[model samples]
Every structure is written in C-alpha cells, then in structure tokens.
Target: MNRCLSTLAKLDEEGYSAPALARLADRRAFPPRLEFTRADIMEIRTRTAAHMSISGVQEKISLRLHRGKLQPVTEDGEYILKPIPGLALPRFQEDVPANENLTMQLAEQIYGIHTAPNACIRLANSELAYITRRFDRRRDGTRVAQEDFCQLMGKTPESAGPLYKYGASYEELGQALRKYCSAYPVELEKLFRQIVFNYAVANGDAHLKNFSLQQTATFGDYVLTPAYDLLCTKLHLPEESRLAIDLFAEDEEPESIATYGFVTGADLLDLASRFGLIEQRARTILNDICDHRDKARDLIARSFLSDEAKVVYQAIFDERLRALEIRG
Candidate 1:
C-alpha cells in the first residue's frame, strides 16, 4: 500500500497526541473495530509483520488513519501503536504502558525536551495501547533521513562487535555531535539535558538507536530527533544498573564512580566540562533536574501506572535524584 499523505495529528491539552485527539474521538466511544485484542495482535505478528520494518522485539503495529478510523497496515502509516507485550513479567506488566507514556510526557512537559508526541489509548477489548506519532516521516509521504548514533558511528557486529550499540559511551555521542553538527554548542546542551533526564527518571535503556539526528526541510541541517522510547526500566529490572550504558568515554577519576553504575552530579558536570561546556552551565542543568521532584511526582501520580507502580517509580526516581544531588 502507498502512504500518499502525511497524517496531521492535533496536540492534546496535555501536550501529547493520539488518534482520538486529532479526529478520531469515535475510537473511544465505538470500541475500535480497527483495533485488536492481544491475541489478534499476536497472530498478525506471524503475517508479514517483518515488512513493517521497525526494530525492538516489542509488539508494535503500524497504523494508517483513513477517514478518522485507524487500521493496521504494513506501509503508508502515520502512527506506531504498541500493546502491552505478553513477555513482560506478570507482576509489572500492567504498568508498562503508563510507565512509557508518563516518561515521554515528563520529558517534554517538565524537562522541556522535545519527544515523539504520544498518549495511551485503548484497544477494542479495552486493553491499553501506547501510540506515538512517526516523527521521521513527513506529511507528504517522504521519509526524512534520520540516522541513529550506531549508524553515524559506523557500528556493526563486525566493526564494533556484538551488542555494539550498548558497547560505547554516551560521551562518544557528544563527541559525534561536535564533529557533525553545524551548531554543536546549542545542540550539545540539548543532548546534555536529555542524558541528565534519562538518569533522573531511572531509564536503563537509552541505547544508541534511541538517540538520532534527523534532517528537516526548513533548516536543511541535521538536529536531534524528538526523543522517544523513554521509561523507567528500573521498575521492572530492579537489578539493572542505573544506566544502560556508560556516560563517559574515558575512565572516571577515582572518586567519580558511584554505586550501581551510578554517577555523581559532579560526574555529570565533569562530563559536560570535558565537552567544552562550562562548569556553571553543567551545574544549572543538573540542579534543575534534581529540583523538579514535586512536578515529577505529580506527573507520576497522574499517570496510568498502577498505584503501587507509581510509588515504585517515584521511589526509584527519588533514589537516583538524591544520588545526583548528594554530590553537589
């Protein structure tokens, strides 16, 4: 199928977007014949699902909105919708959608980072689904050239070895922006804030592919894609390190490393300083993140996560925020 027109979605009252807010309010009322039950989604996975071509083993379906109704399609789509994965642990599975939805919302609304516009909607069976707009595709049906850090760094199993995406430090990404971005000084700060946000929220999965450079027709130069795929992985993987990958390129000084792959605010400041950012600017960003706890907690409570999961999410966030602030 040919996706000939770009989808136009409306910004929600809360700064997120979904098919319902744009023109499909009927989805909520009508029970979405176009939507699926979890079992139906699993069956579709066996049918040309690979043709949809996005990565991550999570159960996602490409969707096209025709005349205010959404239908699953392998091509010419505007949104990527995810149902709760059957593989997630039974105890924590219900929180996954809200965990992700709230984190992406928190990134944009509180931290001022641009993120893929998203919201939680329901399937016909009333199962929760997370839907996010496709930022890399234009309304005219042309794909914007976007490259993840893995591709930009020329990484592969042969070149960088297996698990290459997680093998490098985020500091390498900073080094890359310096080399490729025409406006590094400005974009550099955005990247810095994102890293800080990821740490504060306890996301242990911000690997190379989650960060990307996208070309915009207006600017004619590459800048960061709206951040997506953010969540508190710590809730599920309680044993996981505070970060998925290292934040620094060189070895940390003797005092820099903290517990559990954690780093200090000073460590983050040092990271910024190494990248030509001054100590004061680094401190400003780090402190701003730490100081936003009340707002962060508010968002958590308002999220779709179960009450217990919200408490756990907040606790993980508090633990990490304190870790960063304690070093100040």
Candidate 2:
C-alpha cells in the first residue's frame, strides 16, 4: 500500500515487493516483526560485549533468517540489525535507521553505486531498525576474505593512535586499490563514483573502515566491496566536517582548496587525473551524478523519514551540490 524499505515498491501491505521477497528469502515470505525492542538490544550488547566481534557506536546485533522469520543470533549472522542509537546519541537520533535505508537506496537505485542490500524493518516496539544483509558471507555459509583499508594499510589504534581510521586521505585509498587489486583500472572508476556519491548524499563517515576490498570469485584478486554504512551524517551532526577524510594528501591537494577553503569540481577532476581517469571519463561521471538530483529528491520524498527530516536532508543535498559546483 505504501513504500517499503526493501524495494520502496508499492505493492503489498506486507511492505515488500515480489522481487524483494525473493532476494530476502527463498519462500518469498515477509519476515515477522523483530521479537526484541531497542532497549533489549542495548542490554544484549552490554551482556555480549566481550564475545561480539562486530564493533560500532550504534547498538547492533547479528541476525539470521530462520523458518521464514528473522532471528537474533550470536554467530554466523547473515544480516546485521542496527536500531536507533542510544539516548546519548546526536540530534535527530531516531531518524538514523530511515536515513540509512533511504541513502543506501539512493546510492544503488539512482546513482548506480554498488551497495549492500538494506532495508528498514519495524521492531517489536514498532520502532524502525536498519537491516543489511552481509556481503562478506555466501549463501552456503562460507566466509569470503575481506579487509578494510585500515587493515590493508597496517594501521591500528595502538600504533596509529585513536584517530587512525581518519588519518589518511581518500587518495591513499585509491593508492591501496591500485596496489592490491589487479583490476585497478576498472575499480578506480567505481571508487571515484562512490566518493562523489558520498559527497552528494552528505555521508560524512566514508572513512577507511567503510571502504574495503573483498576477494572476488577469482582467488588472490580483490576489488572494492559494495558500499555500506552510508547515511546523511549531516542530519545528525550538522556542525561536523563535510567529509570523514580529505580528498587528497597535503601535497596533491588542488589549489582551489587553499584559495577557497573548500573542494570544487575542478579539484575533483584533478583528483581523477591522479587516479588515471582522463578528463572526458571524469566529466561524464560528474555530469551523470549531477543529473540525478531529481531522482534522488523523489526517493527522499518517498522515504519513511518524517517531514521535518526530509526537508533537512534535501537542504543538505542542495548545499553539497553548490559546494561541489555541480549546480548553478
């Protein structure tokens, strides 16, 4: 009857389209509401802190598709459930789940960026939680080899200090991909588009851990994993930095940043040159994203975010567009 998180399709009261159901389950059955509330998740997180391998600020738990319903699990979870953050979190905290769902959808459906399959589902308390199927696990339960840029660069909190993940610029990520991925040329474009998309959507948390390389079907060859942990951080932390990390290292930074105190489209094109993309290819990609404003706005309208949150999200996007010089 309305847009569901799975496909944003309007077909069934179950809030899932036929295709979404097929992708999420073999029986095409709608998953029952979660059995636990947000408070329950916080309790479980505290109790299981020592044993849990997954780490993040938000309270989350592993889940599995069991007997046509989603079930919480301690291990071998196929999906990750992120409820609204705790009370001590930033502003507009309750909108986090819906914001993530809509942003991920915009990345995949509108900008053609590869992303983890995600949706917002209601909890037992009727509050929404963001659910994402893990990309690191295969259907038969075999684990794929994956490494975030932090590991790939051999940096740790102890060795590189607490802010290690935010220490490097996005240029270093491209360098890592060039060094590790045999298919460097193709993956470079994907990385570039991802960065541009992040800026467009106000996803300020595109840090080293968020961008990773995964082992492909061919052994020893790794490529950029589908995007994950994407959301409009500006909505929750309005005064934070525009991006998690800088676009270039100090020496390679475009003159525009020093002159204007911000990044410009010309600076991005320069960065593309550093990544081995010719001017034509870079301009084409930039133009393509700029052209998607209408579609992105439409998805935001269809999103489950409250009216006030939607307005804030659109205004942030518009500001980013101007900053990047994509809009006149």
lDDT of each structure?
0.76, 0.83
**What stretches of model 2 exceed 4 Å from their correct place?**
26-28, 251-253, 326-328
How many collisions between residues are there in candidate 1? 1
List the candidates' TM-scores in order: 0.88, 0.95
Residues 1-328 of candidate 2: C-alpha lDDT, one tens digit per residue: 3666676766556466666666666444657378889888888877777777786677888888877778777888888889988755467878999999999988989888988988889888889899988988988989999999999998799888999888788888888889999999999999999998888878889999999999987666899999999999999998888778988887466567677776767777877888998788888888877877888888888888888999999999887777677321
lDDT of 1 at 126: 68
- Weakest 10 consecutive residues, lDDT, candidate 1? 1-10
